[model samples]
Target: AREAGAPAAELAEITEATAVALRIRRTLGQHRVREAQLTALFDTASDLAALRDLDAVLRAIVHRAKLLLGTDVTYLSLNDDAAGDTYMRVTDGSVAEAFQRVRLGMGEGLGGLVAQTARPYATGDYAADTRFHHTTTIDSAVLDEGLRAILGVPLRLGSRIIGVLYAADRAPREFTAGEVALLSSLADHAAIAIDGARLLEETRAALVDLNAASETIRTHSEAMRRAEEAHDQLTDLVLRGGGADDVAAALADILDGGILIHDADGAELARARTGPQPPPTPAVAASR
Candidate 1:
């Protein structure tokens, strides 16, 4: 204390200790704030997993990323390479047209790198980075595609990278370690929901094919049943003391009867006289 005439060295030591304490307090406060924010984000993303529609889920993902990261630009890219070429699907923020439908070879570009490596990447200035190509934006005529700082996280389902989720800021900004971790967690949930939606769509298509097959089988069974009935009726006629002449007479009468025979193809294949009057037109027989 001043009144106690403390040594200058001792005073300096006390000042240094106070400064360290203050720094620790500030750091601890920041940690608590980040923790709270991450908890809320995690809960929100967990709720979002209930969404089953792919487009709706993607929109929610971008919206949540914007909210959680406090960035104006958010984007998601899914790799659609049936032929081993990477293409961009969608983005939350404005992108240049040149980038649209542009395919990149695996590991040839930044997005490609994310897909190939299945890792997260960040850059302070995309234009300055030799690893990224800014000319693509220029070619696309997307003037609003300015990125001072960007974060790209690979979206993985199990060990495979399905796509990538990204956020960008026009003004340079530093993302906390916690924010990166939170984004990673969100990407995991997003991948699961996306994959589930894809599987559901596949299952629905399979069910449709199965239904068509079942209908075809039912139609064939009905045709067989009709043929069996006809055979039994024909046998009964022969057993009832009908000789060839009698059979011919009976067939001629039945043929003269005005009746229609239908086949599985919805065609009126044959006609007979089931009524008292015979058909004025001659009877015609058809085979399946």
Candidate 2:
């Protein structure tokens, strides 16, 4: 319009109108992005609600984190009480083997600081950052992965910090506070899902143990009943003046095996056989 020699006042109005339109477009774009983020979060919550497998749930969480943050890598670390450290549990857009398998001691690195303090931390240049306690192992892995900017947030369940969720870039870039808060929110959801999955696993194992114990008890009870019934039958046979042969026959029927009796002089008195019978042993003679 200015090149075409439009009036100054008219040109000013046009420029102002163009500026207003640009602002509106920017605002709409931000709203759309926010809407998409909200949709993803809702989907994540639904996934957690119907969660069955912990690995699947964790993979989904890290994948969503990488997508939402638009970073080079996204990953999660889980605390190992027995190992006394946090180890990487899941990763998205990661190719380095060492980084995927990295373990961070408490207060050892950016992730360790986040896990230890239960707070969010970010560094635009991790290699140059002196705010965190860096270890050779962590530094070597980070260098190998070529991650320069890093952000980490605690995975908190109540006051306990179970792990850390992280986003990183291969180039130096500042992480905004909004990004920190967003990752933290995702971590909150991830924490709850992780805890729930663990509890469900424990419950399943306990149920299996309970069922095994119940089965054992039932088998023992059945054996006891059979033994008592056999004892009663033998007692009744003796009370009725049944002979030694009758007792031996009853023993064979109850035990489903051969039965033999001998007197104190080592002379055979009665025998009942389900199969061929063998001669009396020297132990029987010794007893006589």
Candidate 2 lDDT over residue span 131-173, tens digit each: 9998999999999999999999999999999999999999999
lDDT of 1 at 103: 60
- Residue 107 lDDT in model 2? 91
Candidate 2: which stretches are off by over 4 Å?
263-266, 280-288
Candidate 2 clash pair list: none
lDDT of each: 0.72, 0.91
Per-residue lDDT, model 1, residue 100, is 46
TM-score quality measure for candidate 2:
0.90
lDDT of 1: 0.72
lDDT of 1 by residue, 75-174 (tens): 7778775867466666676665554455656675566678889988777666566876545533233234666777878889888888888777887776
